[model samples]
Target: MTATAATAATVLPIRGRLRPLGLGDVRITGGFWAERQEVNAVATLAHIEHWLEREGWIRNFDLAVRGGLAQERRGREFSDSEVYKYLEALAWEIGRNGDAGLESRFRAVVRRVAAAQEPDGYLNTKFGRSGQAPRWSDLEWGHELYCVGHLLQAAVARARTRPGADDGLLEVARRAADNVCETFGPDGIDGLCGHAGIEAALVEFARTTDDDRYLAQAALFVDRRGHGRLSDVEFGREYFQDEQPVRQATVLRGHAVRANYLAAGAVDVAVEQKDAGLLDAVRNQWQNAVTRRTYITGGQGSRHQDEAFGGDWVLPPDRAYSETCAGIGSVMVAWRLLLADGDPRYADLIERTLFNVVATSPSADGRSFFYANTLHRREVGTLPDADRPSLRAAASLRAPWFEVSCCPTNVARTLASLTAYVATSDDDGLQLHQYMPGTIEHRRADGRELRVTVTADYPTTGRSGYVSRATKLPATLMFLGRCRCGYPDGRPRARR
Candidate 1:
């Protein structure tokens, strides 16, 4: 396949119930999401880059190239993943708008990261150094594979956006993926990352490169989980998702982000391998989580101590640990399942999560961010110090930065590529999942052109509607000219 075909959308399953539209297909002309996308492109992306540099997370790659990484490396063990997520955000932003400056910055970061890669494709600054612990020695918390997962995702973004561009990010990702397959294949380590990101990422890399090996590796990782691969922690085996296999879990458990990522990856594997039972298992898990574990804001992870989900109905408004990353993870799972099953409920949850949780993370100007989104604030909370990074997760104020910052970069990437999640086209007609002021254009399987303009002030004030025009209508989609839906009980309504 050509680069254009493969890198069109974020989640492109080989065969799904609906085909997702790429960043190139939908255009957010104006609206809340449009404003957020602009802020992300202008402010949040730069704000994240400033902090990554200021915090020396990006420089960790440079330190990895130089000696004394153990002494000089700053930030948490998973800090490298933030830089990669920023790169992913940049790649999508650059793809959305061919910004020459962002492209330059993207290439520069990729170069520094590429230089740090070992001769054998091992890439990380947190492990396997002079004074640092050996690589893969701390599977439960090392986050080496987790970092690689983000790296592969960044490469997926770059490949989808720029294709054969000379950035070398795709090559870097390929080498690292190859190394992973070599080291973690069925013949190799029987371990998985403490974190669950690498599973879905490996599946995506495989799709991008049309390589079965990476897909098989992803499946192996998924299968190997829930079998006591990693040593148990205080949070127990379930915290690492080592308690049961993916196909058997009825509901999402453990760390909210990890559960969501694992479910999303499992869906990818199920769809690719045509495992109906596995797909059903994930759908069941998602249904249960949304019904019980989710917050009204569409956020998850109620337990603040371990950053995990409490038992069913354990949600407390005042103590919601609804980490922004977990919100993003839930969207990932929902979006994929929506594509796979063509379920409007999935889209509904996605709309809720994007509007409340994801959008709530970044401040208005896109400078500060909320790491944990609470439904209720008990006290007149203290504002986080703008100059100093906050160590607290449930900080009352949106901090400029955090000690283990993940949400800001995650939000950046999600918003930068938010257009991809807006709409999708199937064999018959177009489906606009998320309402926004935008234009969607697509040709159906039978070659009928469908173009629609959507206008809405949703989750806010004013009316929401879409005006669709089509060359030829499919049987299921027969609408044209001006239309207005979602009106009040007595307002003049037009079918959309």
Candidate 2:
């Protein structure tokens, strides 16, 4: 318990606060959850890369490297985000299992991404190419900054997990981030993105590189919303969290993923700036969203038209547009808030979304995925392709590909990085967020080392059979916040 020993201990996110157990910090030896992650590595990691290439996302990168869009961009505007997300999955999968094959594939993709970067550090295959929109020109729906955000996240993951990469992916991210800082600001474009992803990524970029410019940019974007900058969009003021600033919004409104992602970034900004008002505002909005708007399966959006949220108490199960990506966004937001103050409540929704929405998105084989998760199905129709059934939200069967293929990669990355959500450390001891059977290791702030072995059957029947072996047992932190809790056979209990 010496000072040197404490300083030598590895730290988790949000330094000196309670440390959330990282991927390496906890090992899932075996169980249901462990099976899923193993499949994510063996089945999902390679499958998604194949889908990206066959779906033309990797081709888009190649075409961008040639400085033209002669093919007119095969997929959606935000297609590049899928590539970045898949790279993130690769980073974690490599961390879990030192797959030389995947590492080689990762490096190759990084080189290709480097070749695609513009001289000025701008990236986004859909822009700056011939017969396409100019760089950052269509901020309202361009998704230029959104793509930048995912790339930054992937870069940070690579740098953290793969130390010897040195393949320039981190530098590509840094240069791109610097370009964003220069382009959008007070004296620059004077507007933030129509999407809310970049703010969180900028803050994370600052944390990873020790750069204040990224933090400032994150704050700039956080404050820039709700000032009518993106008011003229398709969904009016509410579409992209531009309806009101983060500190003033009472409930999560408009696009489900956008609202959740922006709220998450707002929490990161508030934590860094020590702005309690902003933090309180985000917490308040989270309360309202979960209680009145969210579905029983922890899904967010209720409409497909704008892929947006509906009014309070308007959550209809069958008509839900609960994008799998939104479920991932909810986990990201809740995890940050949990790290902010060591509150066990944030872990509640993370578990709900993880089990019900995210876990359900992919099938057992991981060859296909669900774009939007629906709770109920009136009729399960037959299809020519058994893997691709027609149903509400997404296909009844998990389709191998989609015109908008965001969810598949999102699910991949989330499952690949699942352990980071499992446990945490306070000065006193550890806290268990999810009860999956696993092994966890942590060094307390005081330099005391503890290793925990957990055994439990989670998300099946009641959570009564659970056991742990450690220096001290962590309080079983149940996720009971902003929503109702219930059990079948006629016992319905609401959380207080």
Name the best candidate (by lDDT): 1
lDDT per residue (tens digit) for residues 377-438 in model 2: 68883342543323334455577767677787888888877877787877667777787887
Name the 10 consecutive residues with the lowest summed lDDT in model 1: 474-483
What would the per-residue lDDT of candidate 1 be over residues 182-244, giving only the tens digit for each residue? 999888988889999998999988899999898899999999998898898999999988999
Candidate 1: segments with Cα more than 4 A from true spot: 5-7, 392-394, 444-447, 474-496
TM-score of 2: 0.90
Q: How much RMSD separates candidate 2 from the native structure? A: 4.5
TM-score: which candidate is best? 1
Error of 2 at 272 (Å): 0.7
What is candidate 1's local distance difference test score?
0.87
